[model samples]
Target: MKLISWNVNGLRAVVKKDFVKTFEELDADIFSIQETKLQEGQIDLDLSGYHQYFFYAKRKGYSGTAVFTKEEPLNVHQGLGIDEFDDEGRTLTLEFKDFYLINSYTPNSQQKLKRLDYRMRYDDALREYMQKLSVDKPVILCGDLNVAHEEIDIKNDKTNHKNPGFSDEERAKFTELLNSGFIDTFRTLHPDDVKYSWWSYRFNARKNNAGWRIDYFVLSDNGKKMLKAADIHTDIYGSDHCPIELDLDI
Candidate 1:
């Protein structure tokens, strides 16, 4: 199964930017999107042969997530049941026969790490949530996790050490999550690859290829056994974030 994960930045905005053609060309069995930034009824996307599920934030034109699967899932869950986090509609889980697919848009710590504490709480909750779900079946978690993870994951790690996505606290939480029985699919498969998924729209970041590898496809150990290939589609454009993909033998 070929899975695609992308933080479109804004679904409506990307739609007008050849997102349809890109989606068609990728042709993934499951396509997961984060930061959709739109409320229900805002955009009508006709993706033939796919079952679409969306979790919209109460705040209009803000954080949100979505999944479009060619095969219908056995069950669908909208949020993590935590009021603090649920209100933003940051997560969506689709339960298939073999695994649970989680689409997420992790909260940014913000400039100066003002929101780092809250971001830590969010990370802890999500990690526990994934662990709980893994008790029944392994989870395939994918989205813009909002952290660069390591020096190798960011272009300017030295200068951005304390920045939102590159902060030590955020990176530590990501490590804790991985230690809790999950694998960062792309990093594991391509250890030496200097690739990135998200870039700032400022200072010609994309043009210069100065970016952060914030998007991910994380899999539980059992699910990791099925992982075949992992890729970063840096050539694709529409959002500040490019699309990341994972292939599973299942």
Candidate 2:
């Protein structure tokens, strides 16, 4: 099975920039998107062969997520069971017969670190939610996690240490998640690969290749061995972020 995840930045904007064509070319069995930045009736996307599921933020033109799958899931749930976190429409859980696929748009800590405390609380809550799901079945967690997990994840780690997405506290929380039994599928497949998925729109960063590997597809240990291939679609363009894909033998 092939699965792909991307933070399109904004679905409405990207669709006009060839998003539908790109989506078709990727040909994934399941494709998940974060940061849709749209609400109901805002845009009409025709995904002929896929079943679409969306979780929209209560706030218009803000954080949102969607999943388009060739096969319909047995069940789908929005949010992580906390009303506070759910209000942002940051998470969507799809239960298949064999595992749970979670697509998330993790909250950014903000440029000034203003949202740091809330992000920390979100980290704890997300961990608990993933763990609880793991008890029932293996989980495939994917999307823009919004944190550069380690020095290896960003080009200029030293300079970015205090930055919101690259801060030590945020990275450590990602570490904590990995230590809890989830494996970053891309890293596992390409241990030495140094490519990035998200880049800053500022200072011509994308052109210069100044980027951070913040997006991910993390699989539970039980699902790790099923991974066939993992890749980042660096050449695909539309958003500041590119797509990350995974293929599992199962």
Candidate 3:
């Protein structure tokens, strides 16, 4: 099955662009979008033959996630069983017969690390949650994790060492997750390839190809053998971040 994940930045804004067209063109069996920034009844999408599930933030025009799947899942879950995190609508989980698909939009550490403490707490909770889920079945975790995990992941890794996304704390959290069990599919597939899924709108970052691979499709060890292909679809553009795809044999 082909699964795609993207951080659209804002659903209503992208819908005005070619969001629907891009969706159709990808033709994925499962599609997940993060940072929707929409509330209930804000927008209606007509995606025939796909079941849509949305988890919206309590605040309007804020963090949110949605999943459109061709196959109906056995069950669906939102959030990490924490009210503080659930209020932001940062996670959406769909349980299939064999595995669990988790779409997440991790909390960002704002400028000057203003939200770093909150972000750290959030990451710890997410790690625990994912670990618990993996105990039952393999997990497919995908989204804009908001961290440039390695030096190769960001274009100016040296200069941006202390930046919000490239900070030591954020990177360490991602490392902890990987150490716990998840494998970053893209790096595992193409270790030496320098590809990025997200770019800044400023300083012609995307135009100059100066970007960061913050978005990812991380799979548990049990799903490693099933990972057929992992790609960063940098060509398709509507948001600052492009869509990433994962082909699984299962």
Write model 3 residue lDDT over 1-250, tens digit each, in one string.
Answer: 9999999999999999899999999999999999999999988999999999999999989999999999999999989989988999999999998889999999989999999998999999988888999999999999999999999999999999989999999999999999999999999999999999999999999999999999999999987888999999999999999999999998
Candidate number achieving the greatest lDDT relative to the actual structure: 3
Q: Give the TM-score (vs. native) of candidate 1.
A: 0.99
Lowest lDDT 10-mer window, candidate 1? 160-169
lDDT of every predicted structure (CA atoms): 0.94, 0.93, 0.95
List ranges where model 2 is wrong by over 4 Å. none
- Give residue 139's lDDT in candidate 1 (0 to 100): 93
Estimate the lDDT of model 3: 0.95
Query: Arrange candidates by lDDT, highest first: which order?
Result: 3, 1, 2
lDDT of 2 by residue, 1-250 (tens): 9999999999999999999999999999999999999998898889989999999999999999999999999999999889878999999999998889999999999988999999999989998899989998899999999998877789889988889999889989999999999999889888888999999999999999899999999999987768899999999999999999999898
* Backbone clash pairs in model 2 (N, Cα, C under 3 Å; residues 3+ apart or in different chains), count: 0
Alpha-carbon error at 3 in model 2, in Å?
0.5
lDDT string, candidate 1, 1-250, tens digits: 9999999999999999999999999999999999999998998999999999999999999999999999999999988999889999999999999999999899999988999998999999999999999999889999999999989999999999888998889999999999999999999999999999988999999999999999999999978779999999999999999999999998
Q: What is the lDDT of residue 127 in candidate 2?
A: 87
